[model samples]
Target: THIFGKFKFQSKQGSIEDYELGDLIGKGAYGEVFQAVHKETGKNYAIKVYDRYQMTQANKLKSINNEIKIIRRLDHPNLVKLFSVHETVTNIYLVMELVTGVPLSDYIKQK
Candidate 1:
């Protein structure tokens, strides 16, 4: 069973089963973010999937939870809006607005 990159079908929060997984758009220290489409709505979203093992080892549990709390309240054009949260035993998923453009890191480098 892979903990990284792979998504789990079983869940309690929101089910990843609702979304059709697509190519990875970005990655962080804990996991990767992928482009996903709602199986029912046909709408695209960016799903940030984090590995629980890496998050625990990196000690990001508190910060990650805090970020989720803060991000949920925020709504802006510049910010990617959070739609829903999903979790399986091994991974956490954040479904967010799909903002297409150059990667922020690449854009910063170009500037």
Candidate 2:
């Protein structure tokens, strides 16, 4: 899920090399979000890449897993839709419906 840069993500399903990451849209304490595209399908997505090593605590990992489940099931027009989840030894990648607007970095900068 390190595709936020040039890293490749491998899951049981397959390599996420199908998509190449574009500009970063958001960054946080643990991870960053990047816009990505499917090479074959030409579809766009917002990929949330989480640094697994940063959330090494058991409780934090559990919380992340729980959040994945919750986001996967959520259906809302305003919220990003979870399209897929891919995890590796280092990161967790959340493939989501791309919604454009303000970047989190800008919001944080204003605060």
Candidate 3:
């Protein structure tokens, strides 16, 4: 079976004209996260776009599925909220709330 076959995810494959993508915030094992702002709502969000080809080959489709499931189940103030997910032909974009805080590593080093 093909990877990502179980889940039918559709990405907002529109041009970059809708939102302003800012500086890179963090990079993880799967992909990079960026600070972004919605042009119409003026809302801030962190966009995490994963590398489709790499993820598929690595068979980490479960990770992507789990992320969506976990985010959907969570609803608490202490938790960062997941706004939406857009899956394109080559990437999966996860739109999430932007939380401003010092990284744990930075905080630990200061103390």
Candidate 4:
């Protein structure tokens, strides 16, 4: 989906020089996801920023680490591709391919 204008999602780290973040697309218990573009390549991607503070309380760091490991191993059309991960002292940034489609809840309601 195309979101116009600038919107800042919460990031533990100040700002990286490489990416320009746009509107937020999704949020979960752990963190928020935003639409981002790379400065050099001009490639669009979904940037998932995980809140270390929240995740630590839930003891989910290992699970998140495992998920990253599995995602790195994947290579298929049906699976979402993970590009790269950026690690900070307080947050984990997962750079993934942006997939455009309706949410399952919305699709079910339509049906």
In candidate 2 the C-alpha lDDT for residue 91 amounts to: 76
Of models 1 and 2, which has the larger lDDT?
1
Task: Encode model 1's per-residue lDDT on 1-111: one tens digit a residue.
Answer: 423222235545347889999999998888899999999889999999988888889998777777888898888788989877766778888888998999988999999
Q: Note the residue pairs that clash in candidate 2.
A: none
Query: After superposition, which runs of candidate 1 have C-alpha atoms over 4 Å from their true positions?
Result: 1-14
lDDT of 3: 0.77
lDDT of 1: 0.81
The estimated TM-scores of all candidates read 0.84, 0.75, 0.80, 0.79
lDDT of 4: 0.75
The whole-model lDDT of each prediction reads: 0.81, 0.76, 0.77, 0.75
**Candidate with the greatest lDDT versus the true structure:** 1
lDDT by residue (tens digit), candidate 3, 2-110? 2434333543434334568898999988899899999988989888889888888999878888878898799999888877766667787777889888976889999
The C-alpha local distance difference test score for the whole of candidate 2 amounts to 0.76
lDDT tens readout by residue for model 4, 1-111? 101112122334223447899989999989999999988889898899998778889998878888888998989998878876666657778788887789667899999
lDDT of 2 by residue, 1-102 (tens): 343233235655346667899999888777899999988889899888887888775446667677777886888787778877776777788888898776
Order of all candidates by TM-score, from best down to worst? 1, 3, 4, 2
Candidate 3 lDDT score at position 79: 89
lDDT of 4 at 4: 10
Q: Identify the runs in model 2 with alpha carbons over 4 angstroms from their true place.
A: 1-14, 57-59, 104-111
Error of 3 at 100 (Å): 1.0
Q: Per-residue error at 76 for model 4, in Å? A: 0.9
